[model samples]
Target: MFSPTSFDSRRRTLVSWLLPVALAGACSLAWGQSASDWPTKSVRLISPYPTGGAPDAMARVLADKLSKKWGKPVVVDNRPGGNGFIAIDAFKRGAKDGHDLIQLDSVHLAAYPYMFKKLPYDPAKDFQVIAPIFKSFMYFVVPTNSKYQTIGDVIADAKANPGKLDYGSWSIGNPVHLGMEELAQIAGLKLQHVLFKETTQLYTSVANGDLPFTMGTAGTAGPLIKAGKLRPIAVAAPYRLPAFPDVPTVAESGGPKAPYEVSGWNVVAGPKELNAAIREKIRADVAEAMAGADVKERFINFGYESLALDRKQLADFITSESARHENIIRRAKIELD
Candidate 1:
């Protein structure tokens, strides 16, 4: 039989061991609860474009609204260049705790994978889709004073003078170039692609009568169209935009009714492995912010169609867009240098 003192000593030792385990459990629970209550500090929104571009502008607007709504400073960081790989790399290195978010676009997430032989990041594995902010219509525009009134007229001219007619875009592999190529394939007309280094130059060339026309996002073309320097011939969207009710859609513009839709989409994403609770919180806040009256008005002013899709919806849309762009790129034989 064991002595009473010995039994008491064993009990004490057992208690000593169990106390630490209980304390550890408590600490873990506290930590998890704290994490559940996220946005304890400022949130960083990374924009992969220059300061004046549409993506950057959208990021600023969202950051302002989110900052006010959450009572936390949401900073917009512009890491422009390197085809958005620079900003994406910065985002990957950020905290996985959901304090860092990236404003990603369809080109970087959907089209770049197929356009380039090897992309720097993996769309499926590197990022988690939080929510979609907005969708911008892609417009085919010409000088307001030009004689060609419709897409058919442009196609007729291109066919009549195959290599003489030129259309400009910001760069190769951009949606403008790819969309024009897709349009050319459908219309059975070849065009000389005039590449510009920036949208300002591209639009200026068109506005100055140096180039006949170009394709651009509504955000970039809205002010120009409103100012009467650019005339929208057709919008490559599913339906007519509310902002531009008079403009015809590609389907309505005498083009092949096949889905020739291309638009600039803005989505919020974080590095892979973000906590589910934090992700849901941010998504909910952003969706709510987007639905607010001020945000909606601003989106309309920028000619963006507000989209407040949840994670599953955003994932599905991204997947479909990826497949759609893959087919379009393959058919157009578009490869980046």
Candidate 2:
């Protein structure tokens, strides 16, 4: 028979070895479970646009797809006011997890820092960008019955009339406003800016002849253009859009084109300091969703160009875009009220 001391020693050794193994297995299981149990409840996707806008449309599509992927409901909260501060603020104040996603425009990230004298938030520190949702180039549009047929015609008329050429946009620092400001500056013409409550109002004013010209996304103006209420004179892109094959690019439209290719874009981002695993999962799923045929078709129908970028790439891109806008805004001396 084994001595009691020897048996006790062997038992202690076995227990010691099994304890570590069991603990490790438990830790591994818990780690896996935490990831699997993510999105414990409904996800909130806050949008900075009102109803019937492109961002809202895209968010609803994304919400539905993400809901299916996460096995949870995803809702798009539309809060449209205070130049996107209201929605963004709510997102910041809400959940710190990846469930609180926000649809942000590139201008909000890139140009606002330079445009505003004092911004309310620090974008670099307050958010982690997961991916770019979509892009839409601006269309230099006017009422169909207007005499200005081309970009050059509009420039000539604006020069002759000075500040009488009134252009409209939803806000002052938005890309629709700043891009036109840059174009007008390059062309050396005097123009007046008329701000409206929303994109529908801004584009409607252009169609109603209340506003002579405005740079807007295709989704905002394409229907009116198709309805003969608006005419696109120039596309703020390097090449003409496939959908608008007849519309000329800014360079081709005889305008003084100095990098007039800044397109408006929206991005997906989560709350600050969210868990990295959840963020990565969100990014991966969104990338997969963007690859699907239905999402692609929906984006196309909304006049949005799909762009796919991973988390790191999107972060780097946002940094570079902010730097680029800083240079342009500083050179142009664009200051807002």
Candidate 3:
């Protein structure tokens, strides 16, 4: 029973079990230590929008604050184009140490799945959304010289001349397009959608009275509105925005009373390989940066309302938005290759 061979066999089995456990513990400790000391070098914040837009501005602001806090250089890399695929692809190929982060919008995370049949990146597997940066409501804008005074007038005219009243948006399957489609379906109106290559062209058409109306942000459409070229009939929000207090809500302007709101939002995301501790660290650091006075003022100037959602809450919000977009896309019958 106490033979040397039997004793050696028992010792070998114990060593086999203990060795793996010890190695696992060492690996876990390493991960924790690395996470705690994340951003060992410069960080890259990749943005899908060009340098002038609100998202780009937000990215710069975030980068500055995070850089100061982490004592590392945080740079914003703009790789805009291909409907944000360029920036996403770049992020996928970038570092996985949580130093390479991305700025994604509601469309990229929530609506793209329902809109496209094939995508280069997988929303669930390729990335992790950490927190929401901001949320902005789209304003229903018409020409200043337009005869339509309220959303009710637009609806009535659409009903009177079915398929004659037209609206414009930059692209298909965008928030403005889907939101207007939802509005048409709900109001039982036959309307035509005119597509433009850019916001300036779309708003220019609206101001010239070639297009009846289109949904736009205050930042994108504010200059024309200030120049008396475009008049905001209503905003797709429950309450009036502080920047445009005179503008009425959709319900106030005689749209559906069921709170027909359409808003676009942006969030911070990173590669999925980032550990939980690193993600939380970034989330916490971002929250702190957003709370700064300078960041708050900058967001307001960009017509963006800051969001204070944590990781789980952001994920849930994205899921709910996806479901909402799915319903809208199904009813609107929108699909892309």
Candidate number achieving the greatest lDDT relative to the actual structure: 3
lDDT of 3 by residue, 1-337 (tens): 1233533343343333223212222221124445567779999999999998877888888999999989899999999888899999999999877889999878887777666767788764577677678888889999998998999999999999999988988787888988988899899998898888888899999999988898988888877998899999998988888768899998999898755788899888877666666766788899999888887787656667778776546655665676677677777777788
Superposed model 3: Cα runs more than 4 Å off: 1-33
RMSD of 1: 14.7
Once model 1 is optimally superposed onto the true structure by TM-score, how far is the C-alpha of residue 326 displaced, in angstroms?
0.5
Per-residue lDDT of model 1, residues 157-229, tens digit only: 9999988889988766777877888888788888899878878888878977889988887778777888889
The reply for model 1, stretches above 4 Å from the true place, is 1-35
Lowest summed lDDT across 10 adjacent residues in model 1 is found at 20-29
Reference-based lDDT, each prediction:
0.76, 0.75, 0.79
- Model 2 misplaced stretches (Cα beyond 4 Å): 1-34
Rank by lDDT, highest first.
Answer: 3, 1, 2
Reference-based TM-score of each model: 0.86, 0.84, 0.89
Error of 1 at 330 (Å): 1.2
